[model samples]
Target chain A: MIVIDSPPLENCLGFLALSSYVMTLAPSISRIVFPKYKKAFLPKILLKNRRLIGVFAFLFAFFHGWLLINKRHIDFSDFRTSWIYCQGIATMIIFTVLAATSNDWSVKALKKNWKQLHRLTYLAMFLLTWHVWDKMSGHWTYVTPISMVAILSTTALYFLRLWYEHRAEN
Target chain B: MKSQRSKKRAISLGALMNFIVAIAVFGVGRVVWQGVGLRLSATGLESSHNLPLSAEAVPSIPASHTLDNQGTWIYTVALSPEGSILVSGGYDGQIKWWDRKTGSLLRTIQGHADAIESLAISANGQILVTGSWDNRIKVWDLKTGNLRRTLRHGDDVKAIALSANGKLVASGGTNNKLQIWSLETGQLLHRLPADTWIQSVAFHPGSQTVAYGSQSGQIQVWQLSQSEKPRLLQTLVGHQGMVGAVAFSPDGQTLASGSADKTIKLWNVDQGQLLKGLAGHIAPIRSVAFSPDGQTLATGSQDTNVNLWNVQTGYILGRLNEHRQAVWTVAFSPDGQELASGSSDATIKLAAVHDLAREAIANSPLAHTVPSERESDSQDL
Candidate 1:
């Protein structure tokens, strides 16, 4: 696999901005991604293709955290940076919990209680998004548009599903 | 005190008899309620769901039944168009065909190296299709019980569907691709964008329109255009879990979908609207279909019950509670007179839906007689 070249640390101001944008957008994107299936074509078996795709998404986010650790240049002891670290840790914990339990074995072993644990994915998305966006105050131009689109599209999908369901029940 | 106890016992016995009579009458009445609803509105509940008590309840009974091969876990069952045969795909990769009447083994077809997960039958009734964990769709010539063709993909085939005319066969797999094939010469037709492994596919009768539901809780309509690629006509999304099964009514006007979300939903294909939510399955609903006359729908669920519903009103007409395990498949006969359900309980049951017109006509003259009531009144006089 090819790794893209790292740009200059001076222009890396955009990196922090992009990181915040990705973080802020995760909750909205996740809202669209995970849900109780109304008409899931595939019955749940071990490593169902849908579950595998979900695993891939989680893997991509894991790589995102590694990139953040390498990019953030913080002083050894800053109170402000401690908040960001806490958020990062919380996001990592949520993602790890989701990724670990997203398997056929876990689903069957946990049974009726599996859904409760799986619901943590949404909360993780919320923490990850807030952590990144709060750090970028001056960089509204680049982060705002992307995050706005992500948030709006997710909300649209949710509401559209709600409207369609309402018409059916009545 | 003895007189009061005797009176209480008498009242309880009367109530119990009424309940028993209700079940007994419906068990017979539903199987043969032929001309009963014809006097009512065409779309019975579209006008109003306030149906008479007679239409609300049905006594459940066993028709001709078939037994399935059991595994540590039995997966699913599929019925043929004619309803003469029953098929069960098991966790052991074994597929067995049974005589719908006698529950005897007709034949067993083989091709999958792993468990056979999904099976579909062509509308023409000549071909039987199976999708397995080994990632292949094997089409079997039902008469010969011989494997005719094997369509291979990269991932495990999860769900399979055959069009109403049986001219087209579609399969969705782990690869997240929905491929439609021409059954005539075994040619590749169109590879549509299915965003996820499709859980179910249904076709509209008069048109080249197809509706598929995704694991992502999305159902979209795709029309085969005059152009090279088919166009996405509409997206119907709402369910929270995986959409497990879909069926088009005989006329193709309505589409029914069952889900892991534990609801069976009816959709209006023309306007792309959700029409009804047939609820009550405790576990995930595995499969759903309309009766041949489109008067009723049968839904199978992991809850181990096969529910027969009045389609227009959503009232559960009958419940088959025989299966000790999950109910996997439900099918209606082409003539609309019978229903069959297959389950993990290792059994398949056939239910008859005969005409009620005969019963009403035969009993009307007897009801017109007033001599019996007059005899009782004369004694009192």
Candidate 2:
């Protein structure tokens, strides 16, 4: 009998974080790209749960880092040393800060600064692109290329939303 | 003011965008599941008597033997000193012995509870040491198939090296601890802790020195003592990636290290100076071995290739692309006539060293730069 082995937990957690993070940003991109569909079923549901999805993304990313540190013995100092390793570390730290300030209490406490700080999600998205690229560039496995394509397409959608907003203003 | 048709079109586009995002999310899971399915089908094969190499890979060289692990990765292989018996340990947590000359299975030992990461044989081929993800080091009687001793570690073992005299075994792993043990007494001789994962370990063939490569791309050489703690000798830093394999030359003067950075460096074993950096493989190197004569170096990489290099000139003499997946380990027979490579493809391939070298030289444009046939013949003599 052929035994189908399960994929590594680290990879599963990483992919889950990526998916949830993408979900967190999808409503905003859709809002700009398809303003008429703001009241549509899919877009409305996504907008309603965006914050929950973002928090879930942070939790998944947190566990992903925890597994690497606790199980794989990855040194946290790698962020200061290697550029490739630093991308993921920096993204995780940004996600942590965003998650901490995600509450209404902190939103009221920080006021305008909370909005500016939460903008770091875009920075996380940018860093995550490089993190995926650096880890999967030379390695050709079954799931890596798919992941690369997914992350790139998501980033492209984010930029497309920005371009659309700029055009609308003009 | 947008028309109703345009509003309907916008909703469809939004739906399409949502669909794309959903596909991307599910695509990762689907691809990983598909990989598992592919592995499942591959594991059904009984033996890899004929390796399924691509047409481009087939014309290079024919392996003398293809020992199949039935779809589990073969992590490490070691040949006896006499070059007769070959022992291989792998992801299945089983060790298999093969008759090198006839390419026949001799025996199999199931000892490790998890994947066996490394294997080293004694100089006399009497004892075999295996390090595994099971967080244990096992010593086996090579001739009798008896379990000699089991040494426990704090974490899964990634690499191991047997000293030339067959008295000491050095092991390293995820624990960031490199520990030395006595083969006879099975006692921990020393424990050297580091700041990162220790991926590779090696012992000086002629001296009381040990070296280990860590995840931070640092190769640290230590001087062993009988009474006191092991003294840190040298910290060789050059590779941009983790050093996965390190081997001392037969004479024990030069240390060869292979890294995930896709380059191999030969270091002065005593002074720990980087003597030469050989760059040819496009992917991370997984294993490196020096020929018994110390003239040729063999290395395996995730590029699915086994490369043979002239040690003096740092020129690649041959490349064997027979394995379909990442080549995890390479070993030179005691006589250096044949080279055995274990791979993530679940096959251990034995290739003729001299024939591949001659073929590669003839095909290479830089053939004249390498030593001529007469010189190699004389060295063989």
The candidate maximizing DockQ is: 2
Model 2, span B1-381: residue lDDT tens: 568886586456545544443443354345335444433333333233332222233235568788877777788999999999999998668999999988888998887766788999999879999998767799999999899898877667899998878889999997788999999999998989876989999999888789999888899999898888899999999999999899999898999999988789999877778888887665678899998878788999866788787776665666777787768899999888899999877899999887654554454435555554422311110
lDDT of 2 by residue, A1-170 (tens): 22222335665688888888888787888788778988899888988767667767877876676665444323222222234358877887687677655555567789999989989898888888888766544222345556667778878988898898889899
- Give model 2's docking category: incorrect
Number of the predicted model whose TM-score against the real structure is largest: 2
- The predictions' CA RMSDs to the true structure, in order, are 24.4, 15.4
lDDT of 1 by residue, B45-113 (tens): 234343222222544545555465643234556677777777778655677888876779888755565
Retained true contacts (fraction), each candidate: 0.00, 0.00
Predicted candidate 1 versus true structure: per-residue lDDT over A23-138, tens digit per residue: 43333333334445423443232223443444444444444554443222121122333453576556655655655565555677899888898766556545544654553322
List the candidate 1 regions with Cα displacement exceeding 4 Å.
A1-170, B1-58, B72-74, B225-227, B355-381
What TM-score should be assigned to candidate 1? 0.54
Pairs with steric clashes in candidate 2: none
Question: Candidate 2, which segments miss by more than 4 Å at Cα?
Answer: A1-170, B1-59, B355-381
Model 1 chain B: lowest-lDDT 10 consecutive positions: B372-381
